[model samples]
Target: MSESSQSRPVKVTVTGAAGNIAYSLLWRIASGDVFGKDVPVELALLEIPAATRAAEGVAMELGDSAFPLLCGITVTDSADTAFDGANAAFLVGAKPRGKGMERADLLAENGRIFGPQGKAIGEHAASDIKVVVVGNPANTNALIAAHHAQDVPAERFTALMRLDHNRALSQLAQKLDCQVGDLSRVAVWGNHSATQFPDLTFAEVAGSPVDVDQSWYTDEFIPRVAKRGAEIIDVRGSSSAASAASAAVDHMRDWVQGSDGWATAAVVSDGSYGVDEGLIAGFPTIARDGRYEIVQGLELSDFQRQRIEASVAELRAEREAVGDLLG
Candidate 1:
């Protein structure tokens, strides 16, 4: 280990640690790809009791990798144990939406799970622990968690919309035949589901403002990015794990290390862009010194306003469905 690695280690807790997304995420974090290579990390991995054995297997693999920055690892079935003194957390475990189930069903089911986890975090985690909810119905699930975790600052909890944001960038880059890094300021608004608006109105490509074909933007681009998960499932026989994990890393890393440009995340809104106050919604954001702030002063077009309203409505409905969990 280097001298830097000998410094105080940051503790990171990941729920659903044996699941596919966590499987992809743990290795990157252990290798210091999320936090700086110089910053040592101790991983606290959590899963249900049933998955404890699988989590042990994952720990074995992590041990085999011999990550120089990884100082320690703990696998647990208890949230309180997993979150104890955690500096950061990834809430990647939730009951997935099964076939023929409605979105409300998923939200209610996850509410039961996140509510307890949130209470545990509030009671056991570090006061500054930053959380990212990566499971499906993530925005509302994050809201439930934050609501229950009253001791933790509500802003510290956010949902994973970086996946949608990255999807938008990739789709635009493919159309323009440019690298994904050449794009900036792309934002995904409102919910993480089909109602999301992947707006390019504020985006720039290759340092020039993007002026895309309206027909393509409406017909091809928006749907492609919004439903990319379904598209992947159709082609790959499974829902996205790798891409989702990569986006989670991007979200947490940029959040802690500072973003190079505007990134999108689903954060608790204080009525920005007319989103309901206290709602967790996606917005164009920037991170600095380990905090995320929604980008301010950007004027939205009428088209953007209408699309955003539609999505916010969906979020409001979700909040209503899980109203009891909020308390």
Candidate 2:
């Protein structure tokens, strides 16, 4: 905490501090892209025991940057240590699906990682702690974390669907020849995987509805945004790094500071739009006063309903696979 600042420094903990995404993400939070330029941040970075040295090196770089808003840094291998007294947390580390690995295996492995971390968060984090899970299969990972964190409100936990949301915006912008800012009510629904539906039903540019061919929306836009991560991996030879980091920043920033228009995020479903209760599913929401209220009563076309149902089915399957790990 700095006396010159308006408030105490936000203790923001980030997992996987040694990874590429964290490398980009740390700078954003430290330099105040997340909580605003005036708000100070005390960063607590978490890594596995084997990556401790590498995390320390990253900390050294942060020191060199001399970001004015970064008041303190703590690099540790202990989740308890990383989350203790934290105000916000980014759960970004998970086992990547290796070649020939089954989906069930991946879910079980990530369950083990998030389960204990969630317990630690419940035990050690601040009462108002907000968590965003950013690893692969983020929605399920978030569900496991939230289920284990019995004391924390389930609404406080979310997964990063902002990447999908942003990807949809960019793809639409390119097609419509409009700035991304011109598009409003653009949303991504369902899983963050290829099954996600990039809804153009309500998209508008300059306050006018986007009038594009239905074939382009289905054949080109949907798959493009849904498969963008794999496309990035194919070209860049790495999973999305900077873009994923940027989306994480956007998700947390909007959640903390609020947003003016609709923002898409994967939150615990309250049976909205027929999504099963207790499942973490993507939805369009309004964030205000540090809370997200799911947009209600939008009439879905039959096609939209079917698409969302398929994605939610995937989420339900994931939950079932990791049922034993849920606390």
**What does candidate 1's lDDT look like per residue over 241-301, in tens digits?**
9999999999999998898799999999989999999999999999998888999999999
Candidate 2 Cα errors over 4 Å, as ranges: 1-5
lDDT of 2 at 136: 82
Could you tell me the TM-score of candidate 1?
0.97
lDDT of 2: 0.91
Q: lDDT values of the candidates? A: 0.93, 0.91
Candidate 2 lDDT over residue span 229-272, tens digit each? 99999998988989999999999999988999888999989999
TM-score of 2: 0.98
Residue 237's lDDT within candidate 1 is 100
Q: For every model shown, what is its TM-score relative to the native structure? A: 0.97, 0.98
